[model samples]
Target: TNTPQPKRADRSKVYMADLESALHYSLRVEAARAAALSGAQLDAFKCYVATLVKYFPGRSCVQTYLQSLDTWLRNWTEPELPRSILKEAMKNNRDASHPAVLPTNVTWVGCQGSEPHFRGYPCGLWTVFHLLTVQAAQNGPDKELPLEVLNTMRCYVRHFFGCQECAQHFEAMADESMDRVASREEAVLWLWSHHNEVNARLAGGDTEDPNFPKLQWPPPDMCPQCHKEEWGVHAWDEQAVFTFLKAHFSPTNIYLDYTE
Candidate 1:
């Protein structure tokens, strides 16, 4: 008899399952400490807390989960318990909380790829930021609010993201031009443009999934008006791109498929 294959998530749409999986993985990695963290790691933990508190639509369960984790992290070292005691306390805190819920209104089609090594974490994470930026823009009359999302994302990636070189590169990019973003709308566009640039740079690199090659996203087929030929060079119509992104990342686009 042949062994059974695991059922794969739907590749055509972003499943809530994958996004929650990614978030859970991040929380475990960031919090799995057997000893007290160094100063830098502590700062990273602080950033993680800010990322949760900054506000986004939906996912009330996730907000509660992070809040509980933050409570434990803050109280940690008050009495400096033995390592075994501390570990048990952390375990109890996590167990008391509800299961991790997917972030609000985030989706990426490639999350389920032909090969297991392709798209998973990066895709899920980008969807989260994209959803967050869009939601921040929606909730904004405060021009500074949207940029808060961008900055929090930068800090989270700089400190918590496992890929050090990738984190440094993202930090450099944010440092280079993020200050120039002046309005809520501009913050949304800035992230989309930079995401495209990263896609362009990695298009044919070893990490590129041959089955789903990276492209300047929202290709012509997806949004014809977003692209154009200028002096025989490809370019995007900023207004169209902005419109597409706002609609694409909106809550209505989120799918509950494959979710618990």
Candidate 2:
């Protein structure tokens, strides 16, 4: 008998199942525990956080989610941390900058891909950005919504993402089209489209996880309304896809059953 394809409701179920594993890898297994954030890294991370606080359009819960990150970043100071110098670095990009620190001692769950090096951080990172985008949409400013998040991503990718090649590719993609994003929904769609483009391009490539091969997201089986076959090519129903993405990444749907 053929196994039934899961519906939209099942989307969160799948992610939730992976949640514990993803968090463990992102926070513990793969992070560099000892060294504090570098000056450039701080700038990039701050830019990301500030962008979340200053842009995107929505309200209460989402804003609080962003603020929580802000609070955590602010409170992570250690006696060994170069406070004054870090302060100066943050000052340099007052108009455009941020920071990042690697956490340590975490365990793993859904993030252990086909091999030791295949998934982990990459999977968790995707979930992180998607959560922010969806949260912002539900409660961010009406203006600068998309560009804010896009720019934040650009800054972080350029300065902090471990995979230099992937970061460079994202930079090229942003240069080619990120400026086109002009609204809340556009921001979500822009990220989703770019991600799918990457998936299509990497579907059968070397880096793909054998057990998690990249497929066009929210595949036809997962959210049939989001896609359609036309002229022998799959065409996206933009609004439908957008709705699915928002739901899939919604903060409310994110499972909190795992440890941080």
Candidate 3:
């Protein structure tokens, strides 16, 4: 005589089947919703969807699917992406001519600039991996990121870009920028300092001399943020500095009270 199986097992299987069907329907609904988005909103939605597919494949229960979707929506719909070097790079390069073809924010941060400082920036492959890890950390009971994704990012960052000090600094700055700082004033202060440092270096014959430089060979310290190393130093192009600042910072107000 064979023993009878418990009724609960049969019921559990049936419930699972129903859950799968619901999940299929929900995925379709989400796809439709994504289709309706436009501009940056649509782009971001698509990115999230793509990320979900890459990290979590195969069929899932309706409740699990919906929970993951909701969690992703909440985390990504914010004004900023989460903390990651790639995220910072993406934000900086969002206005670049080719945003879609590039890696996510962290890889972008590691790679976007032409400076020698950014030569070892992360590649697209590594970027994908790093992003997968971030997705895992963001997951909770309602959401779960596959451990595989995190491992992928780690492997890519380590293998492709290696570890460097500048890359590390860029990551730190990206983290700081996310907090929005005290105000635009504070942000500008940092931007201005960077500008001054570059200009001062140029004035001291640090950069290659050009016939038609944007600013004078030795630019003047026009803005209050500007500092002079010597009294006899040549005056710099105040206008050029102003233009560069405007392009980068887009200051809303100009305070000239620092002028003589």
Candidate 4:
């Protein structure tokens, strides 16, 4: 038989030790960076770093650590550098060493000078939401919302709204709005406004009441077919739309499609 073997290491303990070691390594790296920079410049860097820490804490408090590095930078330099120089240095450092940290899902859109029908369509909301979905998806597979929710929303847009095109447009708009929204309240308000507008027209009245207005009796254009076909389609009437939007939009379906 062979000589006795040394004791085996505990797997959990090893994992914890590895994690602590990595954290220490990161701290050391940041400390080294800070050691090179100056004070006022460090403050500016801290502001940026803090923002990153607040919104996108992917794996750890990288932002705060970065801020500390900024502080170190402030105290390390001779006569201290200007804030601008610090900013430039930080930017260059990030570009070289942390290229993946930059924003990836932001975009701009304008309908002006575009086709008339599509020009005033207000597609910003859709674009934003689409970006939000992409960001959420990239964060992790588990973070992604259910596809069925999107499907349900699409179905609602198709049936009750009468125009698949508008529905599609709205879906994208909703997504965009969600992405750009600063808070949950804003998102709720946006959906509510859209719902109320549709309801007021459908109910045949002004903007005060939340429910859909009664169909304008005798119809504005006097085209009975048009009145029946186009007026008062609620965006979330379909089960799919209703369900998918319920989480993000609103739970209660209080408004009607017509004014009267």
Candidate 5:
């Protein structure tokens, strides 16, 4: 008998998929090991965790994972520790088990990473940020909630994101305009515009993946109503984009296709 082929992953929507989560955890371990070798880097990682716990305590699943991660970071300070031992500790200490802590309804959203060096951590990180902002908006009527999430993300990118130049660009953007986000709606749009700006800048640049060119997201195909042509120049209807972003990042739209 012939073996059945696996289903192809849907590429259009950002998925909460396992492949990138695995990459994310692997990178975290690698970063931890590297940070342990350097005092400055280790300080940065510790700050990242502290900020996570401080800003996201309301998010129960994330908080549990952060607690585990904080414990591991504190316990594994010795740079001379063997990699084998470190890996074992991570396994035994429950340090890399975010999925287990996540809510049952929470499904993995896999983003495009058809090949190496394509959209990986950056995509997943943005997805998580977007989700957090949406959740913040939905969790209450506090207008400042979304801004809180955005600022926490700003700090994360500033101190711990692997790409230093990318981090600098994001931090500059936040410093310049994040204050203009006066309401939860503005906060959502702010991140969407920031992502689009990054896409526009990186398009056709060295970081552009040939197979998955960076275009203004929610492209005509995904959300045609969100786009408009004014005086023969393409533009977005802010209202439409706002509506689309909320729904796109909302838990209701999350698919469980590749989730366990």
Candidate 6:
């Protein structure tokens, strides 16, 4: 039996598709590199890979990256992988990227930082994963989906995120209230709020890309209704934040602007 091919897209549609593909390609590449670096630390993370192999949620974007990372080390997509494959990939080569399947030619648009040592991959990492939660929320009944996304993220960061301090901070943030998320909507809101808190803490820190200082997201210019009171001291209109998060993270809303 042959698999049926979908209808071909028109030129404009093809262009859009290419652009979106480019964006996702960059994200997958970033995840691949981050994971390889984190996963390959055998001595530092000896038991961590086993945990990921056992507990990371099966049908999510995170899983896709982890699984494909076994074979190609990037270039995304595959069904849920078993424990042995991941274990095999991590064998012997304590610091290899497996194969570097994601292309090196892509560029960041919304995630690009001003300086070489600044916001590039880390920024993309947060945005892409947040988009995953939003994507998960859109697919079906909230209860039907596993609540393991945050835990999965937790284990991954604990084992594999390149920056130790950042991972520790994320682990602490997860400790605060990640388990409280009960539904898809709450999951989206939880990540968004947590992200804002991080932004607030880093607003004037040296790690901040001077050109792209982190303000609590959705600044007044981006979403006026999302805020109330004053700049840097206002409370977010939670409903507005939810709406903004859904729309912003939705695949339909992301554009192909390959510029900083």
lDDT for each of the candidates?
A: 0.68, 0.61, 0.33, 0.34, 0.64, 0.56
If ranked by TM-score, best first, what sequence of candidates would result? 1, 5, 2, 6, 3, 4
Tens digit per residue, CA lDDT, model 1, 1-260: 59876455543344555556566656554444336544655556555565655544445666665666567667765534344543443342234347533343333344866677778777777877877777777776746655777887887787678777878879889999999988878888999989988998899998898977998888888889999989999988999988888888776766665554
Model 4, runs deviating above 4 Å: 1-94, 100-126, 129-235, 242-260
Better of 1 and 3 by TM-score: 1
lDDT of 3: 0.33
In terms of TM-score, how similar is model 1 to the real structure?
0.78
Task: Show how many residue pairs clash in every candidate, following the order shown.
Answer: 0, 19, 11, 39, 8, 0
* Alpha-carbon shift of residue 39 in model 1 (angstroms): 3.3
Q: How well is each residue in 49-164 modelled by candidate 4, as lDDT tens digits?
A: 33223222232233444554445554544665454454444331333343322211222122121233331122323322322232233343432333322333333343333355
**Could you tell me the C-alpha RMSD of candidate 4 in Å?**
21.8
Tens-place lDDT digits, model 6, residues 197-247: 889888899989887888777778888999887666768798998888877
Q: What's the TM-score of each model vs. the native? A: 0.78, 0.70, 0.23, 0.22, 0.72, 0.63
Clashing pairs in model 6, backbone N/Cα/C closer than 3 A: none
Q: lDDT value for candidate 1?
A: 0.68
Q: Which candidate comes out best when scored by lDDT?
A: 1
What's the TM for model 4?
0.22
Q: How much does each candidate deviate from the true structure in C-alpha RMSD?
A: 4.8, 8.5, 24.2, 21.8, 5.5, 10.8
Candidate 1 vs candidate 4: the lDDT winner is 1
Selected candidate, larger TM-score, 2 vs 4: 2
- Any runs in candidate 6 off by more than 4 Å, and if so which? 1-102, 230-233, 257-260
Candidate 3 vs 4: which has more TM-score = 3
How far does residue 229 in candidate 5 sit from its true spot (Å)? 2.7
Model 5 quality (TM-score): 0.72
Question: Which of candidates 3 and 5 is the stronger one according to TM-score?
Answer: 5
Candidate 2 at 132: error in angstroms?
1.2
List where candidate 1 sits over 4 angstroms from the true fold.
Answer: 1-13, 30-35, 38-40, 70-110
lDDT of 2: 0.61
Where is model 2 more than 4 Å wrong at Cα?
1-41, 51-108
